[model samples]
Target: MSSPPPLPERVSAVATLDDPVRRSLYELVSQSPVPLGRDAAASTLGLSRSTTAFHLDRLAEVGLLAVEFRRLSGKTGPGAGRPAKLYSRADGEICISVPARQYDLAGELMAAAISESGQSGEPVLDTLARVAAHAGRAIGAASADLSSALTANGFEPRAEDDGGIVLGNCPFHRLAETHTAVVCSLNYQLLCGIADGAGDAAHTIVADPDAGECCVRAVPVPQIPQ
Candidate 1:
């Protein structure tokens, strides 16, 4: 699956809706069963065609809206003229949190765990760890590097002077607070899988929970003499 946009981009995209006109246009397009053309949207919102088109295009530019061209008249190519630009809500999800929470990711992991456990008759927690690691590996493989992968997943990786990596944020903070052991284990296994998939064997993940940070840390792997 494709990763969601980074926090800042998602925030900026969402912030565009702060404008009432844009928000209204978004609502109209999103709520409609079918995609709406500029003329239809303008008529429904009592705005000029040019104004509606501008805001709709703006929303599309920010990925909040999807645009498509279709013949509204349902006529053939002989005199159908140009295909009208229609707008609809983008399929991608847009979620924002103050400190960055990825309940969606957690939920996906747990759901997969449950499904796999039911099929294999394995324990749920064990399945959770396995699935979480699998998900992480996929993420790591797609990312350009370890840090980029971590940052994309909301881990907020920071390099330490000792060549270790510390996570400044926990994507599953609230869940970890309630279920520390399970969540922390999930976090650690996921990071380990990420390291494996990213081909970063130089670092090893460890569970070192601290205040206001991720429970997992990446320490340099000890090298042995040849």
Candidate 2:
């Protein structure tokens, strides 16, 4: 007659429920200590057996939920009631920290803004500051979809008062450290795009490109290549 232990906090959690019933079921399961069986999930969600099963299946289909078979301890019927099926988080499935949309657009937008800003005096640092600020605007004002995309993929960016986008979460760094070309390319393009928007007449976005590190570094002082 004792309650189960509390479940972990919703850390990097994914909620994939279109129906109220299924969504309610996910909320309950997410908060539950013990892995919830179909019956328990249905009861807690105030849904009928058939309805609950349908929702569970939907979650499973979307790669959010998984089914486990546990032996029934006290059931008297045949086959231990088919080895109770329990619903829980899908194990071993990776969730990208940063999302794809940011991948495609953030860097490009940043590059535009930075490039558009004229009067970017010498010194790579000053130029980058301008670019960061321009990019930060898009970073902060991004819609939920954009935000989610950014966070889910690998560039969990944060805003700083001094006008910068801090790399809050780096899913790309985590998942693809060995090869960051795609992410780097995408980010550089966006940063360049931002500069482009800002109107940086002399310099261009590809000046920096995606070098190692967090924020996009400035393209090296333009020099006549020998």
TM-scores of the models, in the order given:
0.93, 0.38
In model 1, which range of ten residues has the least summed lDDT?
203-212
- Compared to the true structure, candidate 1 yields what TM-score? 0.93
Error of 2 at 218 (Å): 16
Residue 209 lDDT, candidate 1, scale 0-100: 77
Root-mean-square deviation of every model: 1.7, 16.4
lDDT of 1 by residue, 86-126 (tens): 99999988999877788998888899999999999999999
lDDT on C-alpha atoms for all candidate structures: 0.89, 0.51
Q: After superposition, how far is residue 54 of candidate 1 from its true place, in Å?
A: 0.7
Q: Write the per-residue lDDT of candidate 2 for residues 35-102, one digit (tens) a residue.
A: 78888877766779998888888777666677787864766666566677888866634333222223
Lowest lDDT sum, 10 consecutive residues, model 2, at 1-10
What candidate 2 gets wrong by more than 4 Å, as runs, is 1-16, 74-79, 91-226
